[model samples]
Target: MKKEQKESLVFGSNLNFLRTRKKLSQTQLAVDLEIKRTSLIGYEKGVQPPFKVLLQLADYFGISIDALMRYNLSKLGEFELSRIDQGFDVDITGSKLRLLVTTTDKKGKENIELVKQKAQAGYAAGYNDPGFIESLPKFQLPFLSRNKTYRCFQIDGDSMPPVANGSWVTASFVEDWTKLKSGTPYVVVTKDDGVVFKLVYNKIEEEQSLLLVSTNRLYEPYLVSVNSIAEVWKFETFNGFEV
Candidate 1:
């Protein structure tokens, strides 16, 4: 059978199952769908429905047709699934559950995977170990593991509050630090300034410098040269501490 046909069969089976489970007769379902009873029968008999109608039916059922079809049969752990607008995308997939970032854009998928792998490695490297790097004091490095094994941190200081301090945040290492985008929060380290948490503003002209911005006005932004950065932890959404 063609791929589309197979998908349709799966969707049809799921729809039939849900309808039967709800104890809705064909006439009742057809009424709910605003379609003739014969049309509902045809759908259960593996006839393809129009795309718009299919979407409408799926929405009424509160599920993606993709979910109904059971695509991506891999049994991912709970942590690996992130629900996007239309579907649930797997961020991490392994025997042991890891971190995942859901993305539908083809180009974004590559970047998201790269970030996930780096996070996994960093997390395994003593970054999440409590007080493991405390001796380094001024140089606080974040965990790099992609696996969901570390706790989240929340920033409280006005200097980094909006994205860092007040919000729950997670840190993971990035191999390609040059891929860092300005206006995104990062865990940045500098030889002269030590460790700082703020959004990166890399537009300064003097000394190839970048500005670290805080969400709160009480804190002053500071400039750090690009060359001074030791390592950059790409910021992930803060999952801890309710706002």
Candidate 2:
């Protein structure tokens, strides 16, 4: 009846169907997932599991969260669907899947979205929600949209000084960590830090970490492992409003 209810039903039915198709009994599937048997029952009964468990299920079953929550998984192409399960880095754009970063404007044109200061905390949680991403303040910067999809974030604090607090920094998504040039400014979101604008050095070569150097010498550089990063946006430009 309600949207959440509908999604839960779709997810539950899809879970059961996937398990059956994999020829795994409730107990077997539960064991494989390392979750209690009754937990599986509850999930199959339309009670949505926690986000961590949802990720585990998607990884274990080799399916995208999109397909895992679908009421009709058969509609997706085999090749596209199979690749979605390959790894977390699967580029959904290639398959035209809206797994993450569903960029769309009110008029169906590609528009740059803004992550307002108030919206930073929720970005980690709702990044996958098409509604939430679409609802983010949308506008366009013709200069940055030549051939890339950019998202702007309103930042605060004095870690990277002179940029001005409340400045809106526009950035393009960094698909390959290798392409990140050292001594570049980026607004990288990590599992630990919700969001930070930093001048970064690419240490992803020798060590699987990044040297987050601050331009303001008052602050010290720190290391962030490659694995801990959730989203990386290479800084392009910023608009600082003088207060």
Candidate 3:
């Protein structure tokens, strides 16, 4: 058999076993991964996914691509599989964190670009684009540390009260997501949700997700998978505008 065919068989078998072990139906797993049911069915039929999707699945199952592609995970004992899950790194593609993109002044000082309410939708797609970063309005707050990278995001909605709508939240970029403090407010940039400021509860080790809690009692908390998150910024301060 061709190398590609052989590799697909291994991945499909492993994926089938993992999903069944978790007692999750295909539809449920597809929803959790934000993928189509049809595509998931194809994956279980020995069809290899694109590189990005492969990384997403690896993160979703808390396993390494190397192990998923090569090992007969179905044969491994529970203890051994648990070890494999813990051994993987907490990053997309099982690699080091990507370098953060930023804009600086002519004086070589970094500027905190503001993501206004109008620019929120595009922020997720263009965050890494230097042109996009440069186009946003820039300002500096002397009190903020020059050593760390920071960005200002304008928040909307009443989910997090006291901080009213149209409030510009300034936050510092967080590289190591695993170190996120529970109950700390953060600006989490996600693929599906755009950008949201909420109280974060780290559940990466136990469930490979983060529990986002809103301050307002009426709004219910929800879990978002690590793979869907593009960036995390710890809350530094906020500039609320009085209506």
Candidate 4:
């Protein structure tokens, strides 16, 4: 079979499985997505969909487009399926059961993967994909503790002063968000915002959100809903020179 056909097979299977898992019949799902029931049937029979329709289906299923097309969702057990559920799909939550995907060096030491400006968008969508993480530039920071996982992100704007544009911030992964200390700087990765370096104020308890602040007085603070946050990295240190 052609590569496109093969991929469509996976997409169709995933689409059918997800729709059935939600207990919605083809007609019901088609109506909700505003597409014809016949078209939905075609999709389930390995017919390729328009980009817009693919996006609509992915959104309706609460999954990323890459995952919907590439992953074998039907093969996953309940525990593994939960890893890609809505909460985990968008952002890593405070739950201890949640796991972070990472890379390691030849010696089995964890590599500090660098998310460059170009890869930020891809990272947001593919953070859970091991292949995507492995494709990024990876390095090791000897000074950082081996017990904690670390990732480096390249900064782009002046919203946070002192951290210059073009600089890279290496931070430790924050698994338990409740340990967040207000006023501490972090590199927060979100579904909408992509990636940003800010001083985070924990509001998870009170509002199920975080108040992200910028050092530059010109920029106003904003609250990011916990559901949208994909990952949080506590500011351990940075590698950049002042302009």
TM-score of each: 0.34, 0.58, 0.64, 0.61
lDDT, model 4, position 87 = 42
- Local error of candidate 1 at 132, Å? 4.4
lDDT of 3: 0.82
- What overall lDDT goes with each candidate model? 0.53, 0.74, 0.82, 0.82
What order do you get sorting by lDDT, best first?
Answer: 3, 4, 2, 1
CA RMSD, predictions in order: 18.7, 14.7, 12.9, 14.7
Best of the candidates, TM-score: 3
Total clashing residue pairs per candidate?
A: 15, 0, 0, 2
Q: Over the stretch 1-243, how does candidate 2's per-residue lDDT look in tens digits?
A: 877777788788778877876779999999888999999999989998999999998888777676566434433334434554454432322223233475765677677888877888888667667888878877777665566668888887777876877998988877667568899999887767777899888765334467898888988899986555667788888888532
Candidate 4 Cα errors over 4 Å, as ranges: 1-93, 241-243
Tens digits of per-residue lDDT for model 4, 1-243: 777877798899889988888889998999999999999999999999999999898778777787677656764546445655644442224554347899888899999999988899999999889999999988887877888999999998898879888898989998877678999999998889899999999876445578999999899999987667788899988878432
lDDT of 4 at 30: 91
- TM-score pick, better of 1 and 4: 4
List of clashing residue pairs for candidate 3: none
